[model samples]
Target: MLPLVHNELYVEFNDEKQGPFYPAEGPIPFGKFRKHKKSSVELKADRIGELAKTISLPRSALSGINGSDQALLAQANIVQMEKPKSMPFDDSPFLQSTTFKNKLDAKTAIADYLGKPLSRLTDLQIVAINMILDETLDKKTVMDKIRAYFTLSSAGHSGGD
Candidate 1:
């Protein structure tokens, strides 16, 4: 049986307000949800295609967060072409150092994105790393262009020569 769903959508145009006798969307204004708790966005299947158009803050904008937040923010698949990863709490020295609070996770993610072991990075990959370290490349762009072939082919293309 189809469950009865509420229709509380309300809208106001330039001249007047529009609403059902009982609004389906809002009796109250939407406010910042409690932090660190999972929240589900309810949408009809047909409307979900619009969800892809939504976005959060950019990677550089995420840089000012605290250590744990910075690490968590690092592993997010902000790169449109990449898949999100399930990374553990990496406590490696490379990350423990002030430079890379999330470097270990980033390294693991880059390795997985390239389908190669971290130990086998090519010279081009090294160049990409240098570029990333020097802020010449955005990590998101690097991952987005991971297998883009012609774009960074001179630097490297995924794994192997």
Candidate 2:
């Protein structure tokens, strides 16, 4: 489960009511936004998927409730009218963890493996590292793929290395 903030955006669509309605992006509506910051209010992925199935609204409308471009991206693949299968939500523990030491260790390990300064890496880089690690790729192969993916320069490194 994850806490979500529903900040309405000002946009007009023929299917929706006129004036300050929620949009996926752009300006905040009515100079205020709705927030669900409490852990109890958070919705699990499966629960969200189920709730989405019951709604007549399109996926785009649900994305608008998320109130961020990243949230929109996360929901892009979900079918608005279909129910999603139950799956473990990885983010729950990560978000609720009392200590960040494990997270920091993982990040540092990724930076070390990439042979680059951690400051230069983006959030996407961290995600890629986690993906590769979870898939249990061999060290050299994973590093090579990551280097090529990021176009990082190295000795004997070809453009697609």
In order of appearance, the predictions have TM-scores of: 0.27, 0.24
Across residues 91-126, which tens digit of lDDT does each residue of candidate 2 receive? 975675332244355556557766777677667666
lDDT of 1 at 114: 69
Highest TM-score model number: 1
Lowest summed lDDT across 10 adjacent residues in model 1 is found at: 37-46
Superposed Cα deviation of residue 42, candidate 1 (Å): 51
Compared with the true structure, the alpha-carbon lDDT of candidate 2 equals 0.61
- After TM-score superposition, the amount by which residue 136's alpha carbon in candidate 1 deviates from its true location, in angstroms, is 8.0
lDDT of each: 0.58, 0.61
